[model samples]
Target: MYHRDRSPCSALAVSRSVERPRAAVLLLHGGHEYGTSAPGAWNLPAARMVPFERAVRRATKEHDVLIGRVRYRCRGWNGGRADAAHDAERALHELARVAGDVPTVLVGHSMGARAALRAAGGAHVRGVVGLAPWCPPEDSVRHLDGRHVVLLHGDRDRVTDPKASADFLARARAAGADASFVEMRGSGHAMLRRSAAWHELTTSAVTGLLGLTPLSSPFTGEGRLLSGA
Candidate 1:
């Protein structure tokens, strides 16, 4: 059974069976604006993008993972907004209450990545997976401390320059945050949709960051290239 709820700031949570013990994950979609190319544009009721929901389900099978795809108000981190960090804070609290102390992972894609860094606070989040994070505000960069963060970016990405992620890496490291950046070769913004290498690289990076075993070949395309034996 799937449970869905409309929280403040237009955020929402959809999950399947939350009674069991599992790792909790919060997926923040990149759609701060209502029109144009928002990161979460493909996140409709039906779409063939990266199976975030499926990925969440797979993670749940091993460790009680509850994925919450979040959406916030406005285009930037509105700390003043009642639904900004406070909304995520409430969600994290509720997730911990339900999952106990299984550790939480905040997975954000594109603009969602930007928000995740801002929303990452308190002592509950164990790690963060930022897929092509955009430039964060100056304040968010300075406050990142005591969190294991993993940044994944496609070398050929055109939406949010990979260099931006590189910059984020530098700032994250300077702030004493455990962070690393993995480059997906020959992949575009939608790395997961490209080929096996992208999927393997991403899954491996995230797995290593989260201390989990790498899953085999999650990609289903035919343009993958394998180099070096």
Candidate 2:
């Protein structure tokens, strides 16, 4: 058996499996990203998701974790009614049920970051990694209690405001969540310029959030710890 039921949300790509995963990580890609699907449609392993998917592969090899990469149903998440968020939510639910209640982490980029944070409050979600994340004013403090969140943004990012991520981290901590912010200097929203550094930061943060490793850098970088617990 492929061991999966095909649904719209079930299209997420599953990684190399461990018999009983210690945790599960879902990779959510950004909005306005092109995929093989039609406009206003969702597809897996989108162009923007490649880097994060590589990160997931690296992290899983080092740790006992399962991977889920979600494709959203739309190109935009405007006005707070987003099919992307719903798709992520459904993927998480489906992953949780199949994986047997393991710790769930959502690692997202850009608009996907917004969706991850929105879905973090849902059942089985353990933490969130927001890379160049788009943080809405309303979603900053929702259902964050007892969840861990990390925001990593590039200072040179013009697509998503790094300041907004910093501000949201502060608000999330104040509203009873363990949250932190990291600013990657000399980096861009695409994260391709410092691709190595971006991937390292995301993997290190996710492993640390899982309590499987300390928050130690694998490579030297110009990243600065803005604030955290």
- Please give, for residues 1-229, the per-residue lDDT of candidate 1 as tens digits: 3456655434546554466644567776554323322234344311322465465456446654566655454444433442344445666766665556766677777756666676676467766777766664443565567776667777778877777776776777678776666666676676554556444444454454455654323211122222220
Candidate 2 segments whose C-alpha is farther than 4 A from its true place: 1-11, 33-45, 217-229
Instruction: List model 2 lDDT by residue over 104-126, tens digit each.
Output: 88999998898899889977887
Q: Local error of candidate 1 at 89, Å?
A: 3.6
lDDT of 2 at 72: 61
lDDT of 1 at 1: 38
Query: CA lDDT of each candidate?
Result: 0.58, 0.75
- Superposed model 1: Cα runs more than 4 Å off: 1-3, 6-10, 32-50, 71-87, 137-139, 192-195, 205-229
Worst 10 residues of 2 by lDDT: 220-229
Which pairs clash inside model 1? 22-64, 23-64
Residue 12 of model 2, lDDT score: 62
Q: What lDDT is obtained when candidate 2 is compared to the true structure?
A: 0.75
